[model samples]
Target: MSRTSHICLMAEYNEWMNARLYEAAINLPIEKLNANRKAFFGSILGTLNHLVVADTIWLKRFAAHPANYVALDMIRDLPTPTSLDQMLFTDIQSLSEHRKSLDQAIIEWVHSIDEHDLDYVLSYSNMKGIPAQKNFFSLVMHFFNHQTHHRGQATTLLSQAGVDVGVTDLLALIPNETVA
Candidate 1:
C-alpha cells in the first residue's frame, strides 16, 4: 500500500487498542474505576479521560483545525463518560461507538490531505504569543506518539487496578492473513 495507507492502518490499530483498554476499564466497580488509587495522574478515571481529550485535540491538529491550547486543559472537566453498572451489561458499547466514529473521521481527514500538504509548514503563535514553526508532518507524527504515550499511562492505571488488559503489542494487529 501507499504511505497514506500505512499511516491509516497504524492509526486504525491504535484506535482499536484504545477501544479495548476502555472495555477493560469499565469492567470494574465505579469506586475502583474512580478510585484515587492510580500511582500517577491521581485517578484512573482522570487518566483515561486525559487519553480521550488527547485524541480529540490531536484529531483536530491532524485535521489542520485551529490549534487552541485552552482545549488541552478542558480534558479534566469533560465528565465521567463511562457508566459502571451499565458497563456490566453494555461492556464497551458506548466508548467503542465513539471511538469508531472518531477513528473513521480521522481516516477520512487524512485521506483528504495530499502528501505534498505534509511538508507545508504551519506557523502559529503559541499561547505565549511567540511565533513557532512546526512542519505539518512532524506535528502529525507527534500526535500519534502522544496518543501512545498517554495511553500507556492509562494502561498502567488499569494494571494497578488488577485489570488484565491483554496484548498491547502492535504486531498483534496482523493476523494469519499476512500483509505481505
Candidate 2:
C-alpha cells in the first residue's frame, strides 16, 4: 500500500478504537473519571485532552491554516483534559467527527503525494524553539503515534480506576470490517 493509504487505514482503525474507548468511559462515574491515577500524562482527563489537542493541531497544519502553538506553550498545555464525564463524552464525539474529516483530507493528499514528496522536508520549530524537519509521511505517523502513546496512558489510568475495558486492541474494532 502507498504510505498515505497505509496511514488512512490506521486512522480508520484509530477512529474505530475511539468508539470503544468512549463506551468504556461513558459510565465510569464522574468522580472516578476525574480522579488522578498518576498516569504518564498526569490524570486520565489530561491524557485524553493531550490526544485531542494533537489531532487538532495536525488538522490545522494539514489544512494550511497558520500554526497556532509554540513548543513551550505546547509543552505546558499537554493533555489538559476536563474532569467531567459528560464533557469528556462530548470531546470524544468531536474527536470521532474530526477523525472522519482528517481521513478525507489524507485521502485527498495521498491521491497526489509521491515518492518525491516523501523526500521533501517540511520544517517547523516545536515549542522548545528547536527546529524539526521530516518527511511529511513521518510527521503524519508521529501525529497518530502521539495519540496512541497518550491513549495507552489513559488506559492505564482507567485500569487503576477499576474500569474494566474489554479488549483495547484495534483488531477488535468493527470486527471483520463488516459488522464493525
Candidate 3:
C-alpha cells in the first residue's frame, strides 16, 4: 500500500477501535472505571485519559509541521497536556466525547497530506523540552502504535472487569485483495 493509504488505514482503525472500547467502557460504573487495576495508567479511566493526553500532545506537535495542515487547526486550541498521565476528563462520557473529536481530526489530518508530506523530517521536542528531529512518516506510525499499546492495556483491564471489547484487531478492518 502507498504511504498515505497506510496512514489513512491506521487512522480509520484508530477510530474504530476507540469506538468499540468506549462503548464497552461506558457501561461500567464510575467507581469501577476509576478503580486502580494496577496497570500502567492505574485504572481504565486513567488509561483512557492518558490516550487523550498523548494524542493531543502529538497532534499539537504535528500542527507545527511546515505543511501547515488545516485539519490540525482545531488542535491548536486544545490545552497542552503537561504530563503523559494527566487526566483530561474525570468521566468516561466526557472523555469519549473528546476521543471522538480527536479521532475525526486524525482522519481529516491524514487525508490532508500526501505521500510527499510524509517524507519531511518533523522537528519537535519531547514533553521535557529536549529537542529531536525525526522522519514524519515514522512518527505517525509511532502515534498509531502508541495508541494500540495502551488500548491493549485498557482492553485487558476491561476484560478483568467483565466488559469485552470484542475483536480488537486491525486485521478485521483490512480489506481483502483479489488477484487480477
Candidate 4:
C-alpha cells in the first residue's frame, strides 16, 4: 500500500478500536471507571483520558504543518494538555463524545494529506520544551502506535474489570486482497 493509504488505514483502525473500547467502557459505573487499577495511567478512564490528551497535543502540532490541513483547524482551539496524564473528561460518556470528534478529525486529517506531505521534516518542541526536528511520516506512525500501546493497557484494565473490549487487533480492519 502507498504511504497515504497506510495512514488512512491506521486512522480508520484508530476510530474502530476507540469506538469498541468506549462502548465497553461506558457499561461500567463511574466509580469503576475512576477506580485506580495500578495501571500506568491509574485506571481505565485515566488511560483513555491520556490518549485524548496526547492526541490533542500531537494534533495541535500537526495543525501547524505547512500544508495547512483544514481538518486539524479544530484542534488548534483545543486546550493544550499540560501533562500526559491530564484528564480531559472525568466521565466515560463525555470522554467518548470527545473521542468520537477527535477520531473523525483524525480520519479527515489523514485523508487530507498526500504522500508528499509526509516527507516534510516537522520541527516542534516536546512537552519538556526540548526542540527537535523529525520526519512527519515517522511522527504520524508514532502517533498511531502510541494510541495502540495505551489502548492495549486499557483493554487489559477493562478485562480485569470484567469488560472485554473484544478483538483489539489492527488486522481485523485490514481488507482482504485478491490476486489479479
Candidate 5:
C-alpha cells in the first residue's frame, strides 16, 4: 500500500477503535472512570482527554501547512491545546462526542492529502515552546501512532476495571485482496 493509503487506513482505524473504547468506557461507573488509578494522566477520563487535546494541537499545526488543505480549514478557529494533559471534557459523554468529531476531521484531512503534499516539511513549536521542522508524512504517521499508544493504555485501564474493548486490531479492518 502507498503511504497515503496506509494513512487512510489508520484514520478509519482510529475512528473505529475510539468508538469501541468510548462505548466500553461509558459502561463503567462514572466514579470508576474518573478514579485515579495512578495511570498516566491519572484516570481513564484524563487519558482520553489527553488524546483529544493532542489531536487538536496537531490538526491545528497541519492547518498551517502551505498547501492549504481545505479539510483542515475548520481547525483554524479551534483553540490550540496548551498542554497534552489538558482536560477539555470532564465526562464520558462529552468526551465521546468530541472524539467522534475529531476523528471525522482526521479522516477528512487524510483523504485530502496527496502524494506531493506529503513531502512538504512542517515547522511547528512543541508544547514546551521548542521549535522543530519535520516531514509532514512522518508527523502524520506519528499523529495516528500517538493515538494508538494512548488507546492501548485506555484498554488496559478498562480491562482492570472489568471492561473489555473487543477487537482492538487494525488488521481486522484490512480487506483481503486475492492475487491471481
Candidate 6:
C-alpha cells in the first residue's frame, strides 16, 4: 500500500473510533460525561470539543495549500478555531453531529490528495502564531497522529467513567497479507 492509501485508512479509522466513542459517551449520564475528571481538557465533553476544534484548525490550514482541492472548499467558510482548547460544542449531541460531518470531510479531503501533493511543502503558523514550513505529508501524518493521541486520552477518560470504546487498533482496518 502507498502513503496515500495509509492516510485514507487512518481517516476511516478515525471515523470508526469516533463513532464508538460518541456512542459510548451518549450512553453515559449527562452529568457523568460532564463531570470533571481532571484530564487535560477537564471532562469527556471538553476533550471531544477540543478534538473538533483542532481538526477545524488543521483542515482550514490545509485549505491554504495551492492544490485548490474541492474537498477543502467547504472549510473555507467555517470559522477558524482561535485556540486548541476552544469548546465549540458544549453537549455531546451537537459535538457528535459536527464530528460526523467533519470526519466525512476529512476522508474526502485526504482522498483528494495525491503522492505529488503530499510532497508539497506547507507553510502555516501555529495556534501561537509561530510560523513553520514542512512537508505536507508529514503535517498530514501529524494531523492523524494528533487525533489518535487525543482519542487515546478520551478512551482513558471513558474507561475511568466505566464506559468502553472497544477495538481501537488500526490493525482492524488493515487487510490480511496473502500467502505466496
Give TM per candidate: 0.70, 0.66, 0.99, 0.98, 0.97, 0.97
Clashes of each: 0, 7, 0, 0, 0, 0
lDDT of 6 by residue, 1-180 (tens): 899999999999999999989998987888888889999898999899999999999999899999988988778889998877788887788899999999989999889888899999899999888999999999999999999999999999999999888889998988898889
The C-alpha local distance difference test score for the whole of candidate 3 amounts to 0.95
Cα-based lDDT for every prediction: 0.62, 0.57, 0.95, 0.95, 0.91, 0.91
- Candidate 5, residue 131: lDDT: 100
TM-score, model 6 to reference: 0.97
Model 5, 21-76: lDDT tens per residue? Answer: 99999878889999897888989999999999989999999999887888887788
| True-structure lDDT of candidate 1 | 0.62
| lDDT, candidate 5, at 122 | 95
State the TM-score for model 4.
0.98
Question: Tens digit of lDDT per residue, candidate 4, span 91-118?
Answer: 8988999999999999999999988999
lDDT of 2 by residue, 1-180 (tens): 567566666676666556556666656666676676766546665566566656655644443312322322323343433332223333444545544554455444444444455555667655454777766668878877776777777777778887766676756543354545
Candidate 3 lDDT by residue in tens digits, 45-162: 9999999999999999999998999999999998899998998899898899999999999999999988898999999999989999999999999999999999999999999899
Query: In model 4, how large is the Cα lDDT of residue 102?
Result: 98
Q: Candidate 5, overall lDDT? A: 0.91
- Model 1 residue 163 lDDT score: 89
Residue 171 lDDT, candidate 4, scale 0-100: 94
| Clash list (residue pairs), candidate 4 | none
RMSD of each: 7.4, 7.7, 0.6, 0.7, 0.9, 0.9
Candidate 4 at 72: error in angstroms?
0.4
